[model samples]
Target: AARIIVIQKRAAGKKWGKIMVQWHPLLTTSIPVEQPKGQGIKDLWEDIRLPGEGYYFREQRFGNPGQTSMKLTERVIIAFSNPDDVILDPFLGSGTTAVACKRLNRHYIGFEISPEYCKIAKARLLAEKTLWD
Candidate 1:
């Protein structure tokens, strides 16, 4: 589900308590699969391979899963959003949104549920300069 909200400058550190979501787009593909009658294993995915560091950030500079691959994020942001546009990711994770925004000239704001993730996000954002420059 994806929802885009366009807003003029928002107050700093002020959280919008509750938001009423209007639309939710289905995120699954149209692949037919059967489910068991009882509580059992569900084959939601046909193949599963444990991801390595490359899967997350593609760099060992920071050994963290929360930080996504900068290249991957940059590609997605460039594809979906444009420069100077407001992009929001409720689950910010490791500040991937911020890094991509910085590189693409877009404005982004997001929140991380875990303080650890937040720290990781901060580190990831800080590390962007070194990676890009």
Candidate 2:
């Protein structure tokens, strides 16, 4: 069985309590913690951020074994890229990343070895409607 764990919030300083979250590959079950010190994208390590930085969408039924959360992909893409930027996804599982890029008006190039996922991604991309449209 596949599973994911998330640490949703943390308490701030010793005297004050403020909920805080640090964007990363995994979220733990910690508490109101200290606020992150840097911009989210700037905090990316070696320009790479791990997946499952947020909720894992336990309800999702379509994905490969290692598929990342759509919410996480969207957040990462938006933080690290712009409307005109060309996003590249080598895995292209279920096409979440490509769809996110289209929704955000960013161009994308993806590659997927699996035919099923490729079909899904193609259909998703073809069915995508631009925000302005």
Query: Which candidate's TM-score is highest?
Result: 2
RMSD of 2: 11.8
What is the lDDT for 88 in model 2? 84
Question: After aligning candidate 2 to the native by TM-score, how far in Å is the CA of 40 from where it should be?
Answer: 5.6
Error of 2 at 122 (Å): 1.5
TM-score of 1: 0.49
lDDT of 1 by residue, 1-133 (tens): 3333221121233235755332222232323222235342222322222233223322453444455456545644654565677878898876777878987888988977888778987887777773347
Alpha-carbon shift of residue 82 in model 2 (angstroms): 1.3
| Cα lDDT tens digits for candidate 2, 1-133 | 2222332322232433544344433432322123347433223333333333333455454667667656666766665566788988888888888988988788999988999998888887788787676
Count backbone overlaps in model 2.
9
Candidate 2, superposed: residue stretches over 4 Å from native: 1-59
| CA error at residue 104 for candidate 2, angstroms | 0.7
